[model samples]
Structures are given as structure tokens and as C-alpha cells.
Target: MLQETSRDPVGVLVVEDDAVTRKALCLAIESDPGLKLLDAFDSVKPALDFLESSSPDVLMTDLGLPDGSGIDIIHACARRHPATDIMVVTMSSDEANVLACIEAGASGYVLKDAGKLDIARAVLDLRAGGAPMSPAIARMVLAKVRDNKKPAVPQSSPASDTTSLTRREAAILDLIAQGESYGEVAKMLSVSVGTVQTHIKNIYGKLSVHSRGEAVYEAHRRGLLQLGRPPGKRS
Candidate 1:
């Protein structure tokens, strides 16, 4: 496992094909004092090359590129830098594209139409161990999950709900399912970021999930969470 990157001002790598959109996205990330623009590229190969040398704390990429699909870059980042938080900023929301990115380790998916502020905020939330997804993207994922559902779950052994999560862990899991970042959750609960992170780990342990997405999905599968975001979490 890779050691965590120091993310005082979260380091961001952006890959977009369009010159205009690329410039705008980079500028928006730069506009946020809490984020730093590590590098920006308009192609998959160069972005892949950059990842070979330095792993940014966050990667924001468009799905289409001249050389190849952004999904390629996402898979590369997920392999080389598992600690990196990936957000897909794409114009395409096709079911295959959305599912592919998430499977490739993307935790956030925002449409290209989102404003610059939304773009930047998504990076912040992603780096803070949150799954910041567009509402449509969230719906798409949930729809797929529902479609895959069997009429009846195995009455046999599923992960035991009786395992029990602490009240604090339950609260943190709920906020996380609601797409709240650690900083946001800390603020909401009047706790330190460290405190929230600790609870997050405990939640993962109790839920037997290795990632935030898995924790959310497992909780939802167990009826502890309903997999949907409220309004205003576009970032």
C-alpha cells in the first residue's frame, strides 16, 4: 500500500481534451486556496507519464481523449497510486462509461456542465475520503444496483448486522452516505478531522468494507443506508 500523500492543500492533476475546458478547470482548481494545481494535460499518454513520476493527491479527468479513453488513465492511477482520489469530469454519462469509471476506482463523477466552483469542491470532498458524485451519476449507480438485485437475498449468511457499529460510527457512516466530506462531517459533528477519520475506519471495520464506496454499498445492502444523495452535493 502507498503511504498517504501530504495534502495540506490537496494536490490535483487534471486531464481534459478540450483546450478551453482544460484551462477553465485548471483555473478553477487554482482559484481554491485549499487546492493546488499539480499539473494539467490534454491527453492520456502524458497524464499517464506524469503519474509515473509523481502521484497527485487527486485526479480529475475527462472521459474522452484523442489518444485513448480517460478510463485508461483512471486505471493507471488506481494501480500506481491507490491513495489518489479520482473524480471523472466528463460530458458523457452513458451507463457503460459511468460504471466503467467507478469500477476503475473513480469515486466522483461530475458532468462537464458543472460550474468551476463545483469542480474544485469535488476535488476537496474526494480527497477527504468522500464519494462526491453528481446526482444523476448517483441515480445511475443505484439503478444498476437495483437492477442487479434478486427478489430475495440469501436467507443464509450475509454480513452480520448484529456485529454492531457504535453510535458515532453509525453517524459518520450516514454522513458519508450523504456525501459529506470528513471536514464537513467534522464541522457538522463538532469534532476534529482526525476524530472523523477514526470513526470512518471503525465503520469500515464493522461493515467489513475496505473502501468508502464499499462501506456505503454494504450499509445500503444491509438496510442501514439508502444509496442516494440529497440536493446541493454536486461537488
Candidate 2:
């Protein structure tokens, strides 16, 4: 068992559309003296509104919400409250959903079939800055990394002079590609959001990409992101 620290009780918000599952989750969270249940919602709209008004220490949400995808909630929390961590507690542990959740900045991913104690422990792990993925999900993430290590198929294209960006610019682009919000990236790097914005602007100027998605795609195409390696390392 992971040892619990003496830090403040982690505040949590549960978002699940299922009545019984949501109730069980709430009960599980509340049962833990180290966790405080802030609110529970069945949809994304109210959850988003609550998040905007009062950010919890952690978010435990389902992937399929009534209003929108749980990725939206992850993105919103990461952007608005960089300090708040996110965990995905859902029934669908499909490869696509697992990858999407990780890319959406979820710190942990557990199946809904997990026992109450297991779920609570996973939440605690997330609060301690640990990414506790279910075993199958872990294998999936590893497989993705391995796949990225394989040699890419070369494509013939017009050789245009490519503008070189600084190391910082490359790092920022990599984080963006990994689905980190500007605020979260800034906090991680111990810089202001404005600084991150400036770096993003410079990155866009150098890469000639306007949107975040476009920039990330261009970075991947140019081998700027080493998908096989760890998050910060260059491939």
C-alpha cells in the first residue's frame, strides 16, 4: 500500500452520469478521512461552472458525460486550475479512450470496475504526483511509446528552408503536443503564463503554424517530438 502523507486532505469533485456509480464514488471519497468530497455532478456544464467558481484539489470524472467528452473537463481544469490534478474513472478502458485521457492531461486512469479501496488509493496516488494507471492501460501506454520508436515512413516533399527554434521553444511545443495547457506548462516550468504565451508565439512564428493542433502536428512531422522517449527528452 502507498503510504499516506500528512498533507491536507485532497478535495475531490466526482463527475459521472450513472446514479449508482456516482453515489458509490461519492461515498467512497467521503469515507476516506484524507479526502474531502467537494461536489458531484452528472453532466459537464454544471461541473465546468463549479470548477470555474471553486477549483478542487483533484477531479475524478467519467469519460462519457451527458454534455461533452471528459477531455473537455480535463482541458478546462488544467487550463483554469493548473494546481488541480485530474483522474479518469470510467467504464470504457478502450485504447482510444485511454490514450485520449492521457493526452488530455489526466494524472491517473482507473477502470470503473475497480473496487472502492482501489479507487481511493489511486486518487491518493494522483494527489502525491504519481500517475497510477490500470495495468492494461499501462501496457497500452507502453505500446504507444514502443510504436513511436519504430522508424517512420519517409515521405517525399518539397525541401523548404525550415526555421530553427530554440530548445525552450521546442520544449513548449512538445508539452502542447502532449495536451498540456499553457497554464499547466507555465506552472510546471515555474514561469508565468505570459511567458509561456510569448514562447508559444515565437514557436508559431518559427514554425509558421497558427493553431495549437497545427503546431503540434508540424512538430511531430518534423521529428520535434520524440514520442518513443520520456516526456522531456529529445528523441
lDDT values of the candidates?
A: 0.77, 0.72
Model 1 has an lDDT value of 0.77
Report the lDDT tens digits of candidate 1 across residue range 69-104.
999998899778866788888889899998778767
lDDT of 2 by residue, 1-235 (tens): 1232447788999999999989998988998888999999999999999988998988999989888988899888866776677888888878887766665557678886755446677787666545666777777766665576545544464322345667677776777656566666676666776777788778766666534544555666565665434445531
lDDT of 2: 0.72
Model 1 misses residue 69 by how many Å?
1.6
Q: Which runs of model 2 end up more than 4 angstroms from their true locations?
A: 1-6, 114-117, 151-235
User: Best TM-score goes to which candidate?
Assistant: 1
Displacement of residue 175 (Cα, Å) in model 1 is 4.4
TM-score per model over all chains: 0.71, 0.64
